[model samples]
Target: MRSYHLSHSGAGLAGLTVRTHDAPVPGPGQALVAVRATSLSHRELLVLEGSYVLPVKPDVVPVSDGAGEVVALGPGVEGPAVGDRVMATLFGVEHLAQRGGSLDGMLTELAVVDADSLVPVPAHLSYEEAATLPCVAVTAWNALTGDAAGVRPGDTVVVQGSGGVSLFALGFAKALGARVIATTGGPGKAVRLRGLGADEVIDYRATPDWAAEVRRLTSGRGADRVVDVAGILHDSVRAVALAGTIACVGFVGRTAEPLDPRALFASGATVRAVAVGSRAQFTAMNEVIAEHGLRPVIDRVFPFEDAPGAYAYYAGGTSFGKVVIQGAGSPAGIG
Candidate 1:
């Protein structure tokens, strides 16, 4: 088996190196999967920088989301059968529900995973699209429809930025019958956002006070829900309607402005810090994706050998959607 290891934290992509190891076999209640494709998340960048809140082991294989096929099942593994396409769940069910614990890594050609942690990929989706779902898709789904911030039909949603989570939020919110307002720093993304169901696109670079623009767009009522992917909580506070909900999902910005208690009290809004959700949530999200034929927006796909290049491209901050990596077992001609 081949995998990329992060030799040390804080050294960025330069610290990652390829290594070979004996393939892992499944244990009891586990399944052996031939990994076909994987995707990068912003969280991986934080891990590389040694800034993620959760502690990561040095020299660990470094990815959380991947798609593959079930090749062998261990004793008592009654879940996915041989030849079934499956997606990796970053967290175990209990861990995700209680403490938001995630797996150390999934960047390997072959992995032994608990059968219960795998979800069957929708037949309509290719391996690359399935690989992108386990992390950001589930997170966005939970942010919009989970207990903290449930969006109803005809409600207005404000999604900050055009990253993977933001785009997924836009698609989901629209499918759920909400009107969407998307904010982006790049003017070139306006057309794409609109195509993805954004009713209005606000260029944050052009309009520094984007919250005000959101208010104006909604006739002063403000958005019912704000997907705060940019992590500007104060701005999300200002942008949401009275009694609305704000899903705090990312920290793309350098510094978050302090929240003013008085302002929050006056606005009567709720702020929920969202983590990538549980197996149940992932299953539900996949159901929606299958029903709606929602394909993830893929910015680029790099071959496994170019894992370092993929990291460098993600760091460059110009991609409009999820960046995927095709594994050795990926279907020929897929990317």
Candidate 2:
């Protein structure tokens, strides 16, 4: 099987190398998948830079999100049978399972995954779209619907950035019937975000105190649910309404300043950290996506042979959506 591994010969973007390895065979209770598509995540970049919070193997396959057809099943497996289109992540069963990080990921032509880790792909989505869900989409869903932040119709949601989790939050919040306030630093993303159902868009670069704007947009009540992808917890405290919830999804800003205790105490809001969700949440998210015909936005897709290019492109900081890699021999734009 052909795979992309974290290379030892270089650093940064140059560290991804395409190589051939023997195809994996399924073990008992496992399924062998012919991976058809994969997508990149911000953590993958951190892994390459040796800065990821979780430990990653030097040679692990480089992506956590993939969708494919099951080619074979091991002795104990029953369903998601051979030929079924499925999506998977190590996060499926064990929240701590880290495929594409500590374990071999799906940046290969074949992946032998735990049978129970697979889920049927939403019938309405193509492989490329399905590939974008396991990480970002699930995390976004958990942020909005999690216990602390049960986003409701007529509630206001603040999502930061035009990246996968933020964009998915925008769509999910809209589908959940909440008004969405999206924040992005890129000059070109505001219009695209408004088109995607963001009730209002703010450029964090132009308005450093964007949380005040979020409060202004909500007529001073502040946001009812804030998905903190931008990693500014103090700002989230200032932006959330009294008794509102803040889900800390990521810190794309790279620096997580200590939160001010005074501000946190003043907000009277709950703060929770959100990791990628469980299989049950993924299933529910897929059901909602299917009901709403939600499409995962793809900013760019690279052919499988160009995995190195794909990784580099995603790290370029210009993508406004998910970056995907088509499976070997698969048609481009499979979505």
Candidate 3:
């Protein structure tokens, strides 16, 4: 089996080591999946930067999101028979602990995972699209429909940036009948976002106080939900409606200053730090995807041999959507 393994080389994406190792055999209660495609996540970049909750494990496969077909089953594995298309659930059911932080992830040609951790891919999506879901898509779904009074029909959602989660949030929120307002650091990306259903697009660079623009767009009431992917909590608080919710999904921007407690308290908004979601949440998100026939936006699909290129591309911060790496055995007709 060919796999991309992580090491502490500090050479960035080029530091990863790809080797043709022996294929791993699944153990009891596990299934062997031939990965069709895998997508990059912020967590993997954090691992490379030594900033993740857990340090990068030497020689460990290093991606959290992927889709594949079951090829073999170990002893006692009863379900997900060989040939079932599946994607691994990144969140462990208990405590919502991350799956890839400790265990070998889905960067290899063949992955052996607990049978229970696998979920059926939405029938309408391709393996490439399914590869983008285990993390970003689920996080967006959870942000829109979390335990808090999430964005409902006729509500307005403010999604920051043009990353995977933001774009997915735009799609899902619109599917739920909510209006979506998007923000991006890049100029000229608004048209692309608007094409993807963003009711309004603000270039944060062009409009430094984009949150105020969000309020103005909402007719001064503020957005009912804010998907804060840029760590701009201070501005997010300013942009949200009273008693609204802000889903703090990521901090890619790292440009925001410290937030004042008084501002947050004044808004009466529930600021949730989304840790992806649970297995049940993932299942529910897939159901909605199937129902809406929603397709994940893919910025690029690098081949397995160019896994390093995929990581580099994702790290470039230019992609408007998920950066994926197609597996060596993936077929063009993934659906």
Candidate 4:
């Protein structure tokens, strides 16, 4: 099977190249998937840049989000039969009772996922769409619901940025009937976010103190939940909530700043850093998505051979939704 691997240059994703390799045969308890499509998240940039602590091998396959069909299953694998449509969860382990470790990468024409890590794709979703769910989608779900911390109706939730995780948060929050407040750096995105069911939108670029605006919008009550994807705005997050739960999931700003412990103490708020989510969470999320017929927003799809180009497009940050690379001869399905 044809595959793409990291080049020797260590030049990040820009160093990725396409190459032909023998199709992987399933090993014991594993399954070989005929990958249909894979989606990109901003966090992949961290992996490519070697900033993430995962310590990826120089020539290892990149990416951790995709959907495919079971072509074959290894010995003792009976759950997913051949031709079953499935998506790979980030962590092969279903439910890690504790935190640590990372999920497998899924950017390729095919992937070898443990059978237990696969989630059945909803019959209503296409491979391209299902490809978008595993990583960011599950992370958003866990942030809101997986920890037994359910977001209730009428609660005010804030989502920062218009990226994959934030968008998922907005969608999930909306499904729970929670009022959503989304922030975007672009004015156009603010409009788009409102259309995505956000009750309110803030243009961070126009209003640097967007968090304060969030507080004002809530009549000084502050948001009940804030999903912070913009690391630079962490302090802003601290300013916007009254005893809110803040889930830090990204570092779009790429800088570290001093945080006031007093602020958090004063508000009696909790700040938690999320590293995506578990396979169990992925399964739970898929169920909700299928139930709601929620289709993930896909910004663009590139041919498999042009996977590198897909990364370039993602780097440009021009897309409003997920960017994907479809496997050869595979049909596009946006879930």
Winning candidate number (lDDT):
2
Give the better candidate number (2 or 4) by TM-score: 2
Mind giving the per-residue lDDT tens digits that candidate 3 earns over 246-323? Answer: 899989878888999999999999999987887788998888888998999988999999888888888888888999
Candidate 4: give its CA RMSD in angstroms: 2.8
Q: How do the residues 1-335 of candidate 4 rate in per-residue lDDT, one tens digit apiece? A: 67777653246766786777788888999998998888888757766676754555556677778888899889989789999999877766545311112433566666777888788998888888888888788888877875445688998999888789988999999988899988888878888898889899988789878778888899988888888777754565555566678877777866747667777778777777788777677777878787888888889999988888898899898898899889888865534
lDDT of 2 at 111: 91
RMSD of each: 2.1, 1.8, 1.6, 2.8
Note the residue pairs that clash in candidate 1. Answer: none
Residues 1-335, candidate 1: write the lDDT tens digits: 89888876676778898899997878899888888988998888887888877756668788888898898999998879999999978775454421111444667888878889889998788888889988899999999999744888999999988888999999999989999999988778988898888999999899999999999999999999999887798988889999999999988886889889999999999888888888898999989888999989999999999988998999899999999999875784332
List lDDT for all candidates, in order: 0.86, 0.87, 0.86, 0.78
lDDT by residue for model 2 (153-201), tens: 9999999988899999999999999999999886679889989999899
Query: What overall lDDT, based on C-alpha atoms, would model 3 receive against the true structure?
Result: 0.86
lDDT of 2 at 322: 98
Off by over 4 Å in 3: 8-11, 92-99
